[model samples]
Target: MSGSEQAPVVGVSTYRQRAVTGVWDVEACLTPAPYVEGVTRAGGIAVLLPPQPADAAVAAAVLDRLDGLVLVGGSDVDPALYGAGPHDATDPPQRQRDTWEALLVHEAIARGVPFLGICRGAQVLGVALGGTLHQHVPEVIGHHGHRAGNAVFTPTVVTTVPGTRVADILGDGVTAPCYHHQAIDRVADGLVVGARDDDGLVEAVELPDHPFGVAVQWHPEEDLDDLRLFAALVDASARRRTGAYA
Candidate 1:
């Protein structure tokens, strides 16, 4: 590797440019965009992921250079991706997100690279690995208080399991800001919940044997909570960058 090359490069997901609430309009090198800021504050350079249908090999090559991958939260996944029919709360899902994130997530896991999924990103990682999500958190579960807005933040408590990565990273328990209506339902295969809400919502999950993977249904980049997970991800990624994996 060239000495001038950056250390610990992380690929971040960008929404497709389309209609409102369709695909996320993610631009290039856009730093401090909530989740991207979360990654940056943790000591990793954030690379915005854009949908490029004509460059699979090039994308894979670029992905190969990174030490880790991050799937940021945005639009809801298409109901059809899962085995369920469109529920009453189903919205127009982001197809590009499914395509790009799926490729990146599988590649990252296969390469023993560390990955962290937050909110929709978490659901993406979960569903990509054979899990499910509740169409709407409010429609069934009575858990309320999570509001949707860039300027507003919501609150909820999450109980962490001792000895779990989520617990060790954030310590004991954490209640992060939540804005999503969809959540993990069946719990992805090979993954386990590390935290939960009083209403039984799956707040966080961890991969049993990957380099380092965790998907959370809450948003920890809201500045309301202590950002421990980001630093942990970056540190683990740095280790991976230095051939420190078992």
Candidate 2:
């Protein structure tokens, strides 16, 4: 089969956490089903990358086999990564996952892999690029609208800046499903703001130099009807696989 006819392999980072399931309570590496389904629906094969001992070489070795990478939403990133103390509301640091994903982000960007970040994934991208995060959104925004609680996704209007990859995929405005209590604070030098919420909080970011590096502070997988972001990533992956971007 031709490169274009072959489905691109996209790696989705998994959450390493302790959980109970069918009388087997133990630590597990898992991602929400929607993440896998979204990638598959977008014409790509999804592979889960579970957190383990990771470094630069490890990341490069893993990313070498994939056409694209997806940093799925998950727990809070260790605040120390950006030289800050954790907020009272921040979850305990998942240093293992933090290190793993950060290395992957660097490797993926260095190798020109099509990549997308969602929710916590967005925060990971920001931090990995030397940016800081607003540990608690409510403290900065004076409202809890970003997260309605009870695992519910609040609809927040996000407006994209013109001429950004995010704008190309999501258009000017969209009511994105957001449940994040943290967001990008100081965007790194190389990354540009792609979109923002009505409150002026950074909601998305993009790396202009890369072919496909976009991260949104919303949960797009929750809205099955809107597969624009996933489709865009998969299309980019397909192009990468076919050497179209080369």
Predicted candidate 1 versus true structure: per-residue lDDT over 30-104, tens digit per residue: 323877787877778878877656345655676688888777777788878788887776678667668778778
Candidate 2: where is the Cα deviation over 4 Å?
Answer: 2-5
Q: Give me the displacement of residue 182 in model 1, in angstroms.
A: 0.6
- What pairs collide in candidate 1? 15-24
TM-score of each: 0.87, 0.98
Highest lDDT against the true fold, candidate: 2
- On a 0 to 100 scale, what is the lDDT of residue 111 in model 2? 95
Task: TM-score for candidate 1, please give it.
Answer: 0.87
Find the 10 residues in a row with the least total lDDT in model 1: 23-32
Candidate 2 lDDT over 1-246, as tens digits, reads: 964459999999999988899999999999999999999999999999999997899999999999999999988999999999989999999899999999999999999999999999999999998999999999999999999999999999999999998998989979999998999999998999999999999999999999999999999999989999999999999999889985
> What are the Cα lDDT values of the candidates?
0.77, 0.94
- Model 2 scores worst on lDDT over the 10 consecutive residues at 1-10
